[model samples]
Target: MRPAPAVVAMGVAGCGKSAVGEALAAVLGAAFVEGDRLHPPENVARMARGEPLTDALREGWLDAIGQRIAVSVASGQGVVAACSALKRSYRERLRGFCKDIVFLYLEIDPATAKQRVGSRPGHFMPASLVDSQFATLEAPAADERALTLDATRPVGDIVASAVSLLGEANS
Candidate 1:
């Protein structure tokens, strides 16, 4: 049997990357990695204080995710990771680790994102940073192996779409 394909659930903070990623992973019978948990302590503190992370600050976090992707790919076990790959460069960096990785972009508007972020009690990212996330985001280009979906939809619906996409990609 062919190995399951890796997927990255990517978007701004409140775009439901984690929810979709977890659901997709469960359906795919693949491992799920919450990218937020991999952030360094200092980065978490900065985000909690509403400070946006510079590219330099995010390097280590990206590296950690990349390492995990490499491991999963090498083992032939798929992984679904929730990450805010805001910049094109960041996504490119991750692609270096796994050539077949597919990006699932959860498209969301700023108002909804801010509302969601504000309602989430303990997440390190603050609602105020929603603007910065928008500022930083470079939606996946046409050539990239990516699937874009509406984040405001129900999680089950989103996961269903992702599963369909994965099935197509894997075939």
Candidate 2:
């Protein structure tokens, strides 16, 4: 059977979760699920309007992503997903679906995050909400099966590190 690891590239809006997740998926020969694309239209509109999402608003989204992960894992195909899993509870919710799920936390400073978010065009999330994202972030605890990478690093380096970590984790 093929490896069936499930990994989430998690962090705040501008933390390169999408880019790193895509690259990591390519390296792992896995499917890449864009979490933002899975968000409800109402959530997108609210974020576009500079409103932060409440926990209640995010529950369904998290469940949707978890479902995707669960399906992929059950098929014995590895999967990598990008999500702004800024809270421990959010990560835990995902873990509820797949016990072996791993998280790749892209750590970034607020200034860089704000600058990056501001530069992205056509994104629903606004730079104005970057502060809210930071406030919501609860870094993974030491016990969690997670890898922390510097968001400032090049995508290639970050992906390489993740590949190494995943190798060790699966071995």
TM-score per candidate:
0.97, 0.97
Number of the top lDDT candidate: 2
lDDT of 2 by residue, 109-165 (tens): 999999999999999999999999999999999999999999999999999999998
Native-referenced Cα lDDT, model 1: 0.92
Model 1 off-target regions past 4 Å? none
Reference-based lDDT, residue 10, model 2: 95
Q: Model 2: what TM-score? A: 0.97
lDDT per residue as tens, model 1, 35-115? 999999999999999899999999999989988988987898889999998888999889888878899999999999999
Q: Note the Cα lDDT for every prediction shown.
A: 0.92, 0.94
lDDT of 1 at 52: 95
